[model samples]
Structure formats: C-alpha cells, structure tokens
Target: ALYYYADNPQRPYDPEKAKQMLSAAGVSNLTLKYLIRAGDEVDEQTAVLVQQQLAQAGITANLQKVDPSQEWDMTIAGDYDISVNYWTNDILDPDQKTTFVLGHDSNNNYMTNYKNDAVKDLVAKARLELDPKKREQMYIDLQKMAKDDVNWIDLYYSPYINVARKNIDNFHQNPLGRFFLEDTVKN
Candidate 1:
C-alpha cells in the first residue's frame, strides 16, 4: 500500500479543484462502482475505508462484494470505476514496475483504458540507463507520466504488524516489510 504522489510537491488534495478539473473535462454524474473481494479481511477493511472517503468527495460509490477470481476478471475487463486490493509488489527495476502500471498487467486495474506512449517510452529509457543517477531521473519522468494520466490513485503505504508467541526467540522483521523466521527458535 502506497500513496501516489504527483511530480509537483505543491499539488495537494483539493476536492473543489478536482470538481473544476472534472467539469472542464466535461465529466459529470460520475458514479464510481467500487469492487472488492468478499472474504478477505484486509480487502473488506480497505473497501469500507475507501467507500467512506469517496462518499465525502461526492462521488457516488457503490461497493460490490465478489469472489476474488471474478473480482480480478471484473477489474481486468475495466468493469468498475474503482477496486480495493492488496498488492505484493516486487520492486525490481523501472521496467518491472511498468509491466503492471503502464501496460495490460494484473497490477494495473485503474480501468482508465488508456495506452500511454510516454509512460512506456520513459520506462524503457530508464531501463537502459546503467548509471544510477540517470536511471533515477528517468524513473522520476516515468512517475510523472503516471500521475499526469492518473493511472492509479495510491492511498497509503502499509507496514505489516506481527504478533508472535512469547517463547519465540530471534524473530526479527526484515527490511522487505515482513518477518523472517530464519534464526527464530522456540524457547
């Protein structure tokens, strides 16, 4: 879970501003149907949270509880305006990230139905840059392309909370945001 920040730091959430933008774009009466998996605990919680927030923004949000597989199919088909999901993103390279975000991949369920050329081009350039600094800049460009297109509206970055038995020793969490049981032993 991560919040998608725009390229410009000054741009903050302004509902009125959003209304104007949508209005200028000739978009109105936009009822966003939000699809979320039924049985998953985290998904249920996230769906409720998102529903509340979207309601406050005056976007009519309807929540649909569906089976997880069907949920993905629906999202992939661009059937809904919004979807609540949990992702385990493997942060590799910029290209790897785009595989979901830019193209037709499982990760990108934005339903924008846009094939952005700039996003794809920038990601390819980033991948070719062996220099870390150059690569970083390319990634920055790629991100802005994503933001400008509004490919995904990220909500929050989440950390895992773990509860272990008292007897477990050396149960340290890893930087990858998960607990490791490698050195752990029962007392």
Candidate 2:
C-alpha cells in the first residue's frame, strides 16, 4: 500500500541521519531525555535497548529512571525528550489517534512533538465520511503521512485476553469494542 511504502519500508537505523534532521530543524546534539518507570521490566529493558540504538546513531540520549508514581507528572512537565509508555484503544478508529497522536495534544498521547497538516486534514475528512472506501483511503493516507513524518515509531501491538470457561457456551469477542459480562449471556 502507498501508506506503508511512503514510510521508507526498508531504511536501516541511522543516527547521523536523524541528527542532521534535528540540526536542520534547529535542534542539534539534542540531549534527548527519557523517563521510564523504575521497576517495570519492559520499560527497563526498552530503555536499555533505545540507549544502545540511539548511541549507534550518534545521539546523546539520557535515561532517567523515575518512580512509577512520578512518571506522568515528569512527562507532563516536559522533563523528557521521549517517554516510554503504553496504550489500549477504547475504539478502533483513526479519530481516537488524532487527539492523542498529534503534537503535545491535550491527550498527551504521544509526547513527540510531531505535527502534520495533511494528516489533520485527512483525519477530519475520515471522521465526516460515511463511505467505507473513502474512509479506508483517508486512513491509508494518514498512516502513510506518519511513516514519512517519523512522528511516532509504532513498535507493536500487545496481545489481548480471550478465554472461556469450561461450562461456557458460544462466546464471541468484539476486537474493536469492550466486552461486558452482561452482553455475554448464553441461551
């Protein structure tokens, strides 16, 4: 798809390239800082991995391990150039990403100050559109924009829980919406 292709589907990681971009934008030798939870195993490991990756690219990244209690507050105070976190969608829609993904948004969904006008327009169009084809195209456009913009590097989606009891009958799951016990009554 055009969206996936535009994101430089096969570019190797390079920090010099990243540095040059930052320099051009008046952000040089950017002492990129990161705030992570002190005891979370995933956060701990990821911070170490990023520290190594950025080092390969010639970027000085500072990792500050903070208490989980202070994580949100520190991030809100702009205490980091990057922050490691997680999210679970309430609904599977692009609009949900808009309020959270675009630069320093109220949702502070992504702390990276990445902003794209085209993406905003596309999201707006997608929201108002009822046509499936048009809506899908708009999303494709926005996703492509994200790839090129390098605003956020979507790593991976975690697994969700789906289990059934031994006596349970015909259980179904709606991936895009929440599950409620009341909605799971058996015949």
Candidate 3:
C-alpha cells in the first residue's frame, strides 16, 4: 500500500466550501450521472455515499448501475459524468499507474481525459531516469501535480488477504494479489 507523502496537500471534506464553489461558478441544481458496475456491492454502496455527500454540497448525483461488459466502453467513451472502478497494478512501479492512467497519449485512460504537457514530460522523464533520487523526485512532483489537477478522487485502498492451512509450507502471498504455488508444499 502507498503511504501518504509528507508534502502531499490535504483536502479536507468541506461540503460548505463545495457549495460555495458551485455558487461562485453560477452552477445550481447541477445533477451528475454516476455510473456503477452492476453486481459490485462495494461500488453500489460507494455510489450511495457519494450521492449523499454531493447532496450535502448542493449537487445531485444520479446513480446508474451498468453491466460489467459495458462498463469499460461506457467509461472510456465518456458516457458518464462519474464512474466507479478500481485499479491494481501488477507490479509495484509508478510507471504503469502514472503513464497509462494519467498520460494524455495513453489509450487506457478511463474518462478522466486529463491533458497536461507538464505531466506528460514528467512521466516520460521518470520512466527513463537512471538516477534513483531523480526518479523519486519526479514521481513526487507528479503526485503533487496530479492532486492539484484533481484528476480523480481517491477514496480508499482495499486490503488483500490470503488464508492457508498450518501444514502448508513455503506458502507465500503476493501483495499484488498474485499466487505462485510451484514452490509450495504441504507437509
């Protein structure tokens, strides 16, 4: 799990501030269509919570449960104002998360459609950077930039758990949710 960085900005939940911002922007009775994948209990529950939160901010969110098969296409095509989804990187590298999800030229970007030249340059530099310190700094900068840009609101990270019997030897669980039983043995 990624821990919080010291320099990361804090955005406290303030429904009043959200209301004021909407009023300043001349937006009233604003309603957003929130797309959720059907059969996902977590997504449905999150949508309900988000709807209540948005209502407190004077904004309306209409939740629409969509089939799993069509969820990807709908989100990629920008058919919904907001979509509920989760992403888990296969490896513990910032490359896939940063470039594929936030980069402008990437085709895997859901509906964010966020485009920034600075972000693009930073992602490219971080990928090829040979210096560890430089790469880390670049990623830090990218995180701050992405947060400021409000690319997406991160709710929380779910933990993965693995259970096994006592006799199972060499049974290890991968943090990335992969299982390799080739070396595992039951004594």
Candidate 4:
C-alpha cells in the first residue's frame, strides 16, 4: 500500500526495498485488518487491491465489513485497524483537506490521530496572506510537509458531474463539487 506512487515516477515499486524497510523498522508477521463500508463498492475494490499488493510483501490483510452508519463512529472512536474512507470538503481550500481534517480537534483525524504544530502554523499563516502567490506557496509547503510525514495516503479523486440547460447563466461547479442555484439565472 505504501509502495504506490501515481505521480512520482521516480519512486518505483521495489519489493526488496520495502522488505528491508520493514525489517529495519523491526516489523514481522505483519497483518492488517482492513475496515470497509459494507455497501461501498469503491472501498471494497480499494481494500482488495491493497490486500493483494501487501500480500506480495507477506503482509496479510483481513477485510472486515462494517455498517456504513456505524463506520464513522468506529473511525472517530479509533476502533478501526485500518479504515478505508473518503473526506468530502465543502469548499476549494487546501485547509479543508489538510489542516481541518488532520489538525488537532478535527473530527476526521482517524488514521494516525496526527497533530503537528508546524502544519497548523503553516495553514494559519497561509490564511492570512493576501498575495495569491505567497498564499499558494505557503499551502505548497504545507503539502510537501504532509507528504514527508506520510501520515495519510490519498487513493484517487472521484469525478463529479453537474448538468444544466444551455440557457442557464452563471452556472459553474467549484472544485469542491458544489454550485449554488442562487448564482444561476436564465438568460
């Protein structure tokens, strides 16, 4: 699961390297109990793929199906071994994805219970910058920091499509996969 690199071609999959890292970290007889929403096909597919991949390195993953209604509570209560879930952001801001989700007092910090002062500070500083370039750079730095920490792994971005009549005006879908009816007008 950790060997995956979709964008970075430089980081090729090396089973030997992974095995060595696991051994160095004093890992042995590794088995992951992967949790998945019972009715979620995507989560099931991802879990299966990850299980198969991890098996190459002798890591056995036991898939556990959980009720979707109780899944969030389980994750929030930290009762999961490894949860496969997605976060939906309300707006197009890096803070929604990184800081608000992974920061302290966040509702969705399920994986590692991760909280870093540096990340919080970066997000805070970025929020204050009026210069677009400066703000972008600050978030970029935050992204790099999060990647280096390797606390969270994003699998994929699901596509969302919005349909509207040709005559509709001011119809635009934000990156957050949402649009407001108030902004639209018949032209």
The TM-score values for the models, in the order shown, are 0.78, 0.73, 0.91, 0.78
Check candidate 3 and list the clashing pairs: none
> Residue 79 lDDT in model 4?
74
Candidate 1 segments whose C-alpha is farther than 4 A from its true place? 1-11, 91-95, 103-114, 177-179
lDDT values, one for every candidate: 0.69, 0.70, 0.83, 0.72
Q: TM-score of predicted model 1? A: 0.78
The best candidate in terms of TM-score: 3
Candidate 4 lDDT, 72-95, residue by residue in tens = 777777776787666777756656
Worst 10 residues of 1 by lDDT: 1-10
Q: Write the per-residue lDDT of candidate 3 for residues 68-170, one digit (tens) a residue.
A: 8788888888888988778888988888788887777656454688877898888888889988788888888888988899888878888887788999988
1-187: candidate 2 lDDT, tens digit per residue: 2122243454567877877877788874656778889999999898889888887766777888889879878876667777877776677665676657852366454656566777766667777988877777777766666777777675556667787867766566666546655556544
* 46: Cα error in model 4, Å: 1.4
Candidate 2 residue 74 Cα shift, in angstroms, is 2.4
Report residue 176 deviation for candidate 3 (angstroms). Answer: 1.5
Error of 3 at 169 (Å): 3.5
Candidate number that wins on lDDT, 1 or 4: 4
* Count of clashes, each model: 3, 1, 0, 0
- RMSD of each predicted structure: 3.6, 4.3, 1.9, 5.1
Model 4 gets an lDDT of 0.72
Q: Rank the candidates by TM-score, best first.
A: 3, 1, 4, 2
Q: Which of 3 and 4 is ahead in TM-score?
A: 3
Q: For residues 45-136, what per-residue lDDT tens digits would candidate 1 score against the true structure?
A: 88888777656656677889999899878987878878865445565344665656675444442445657876767666666778877777
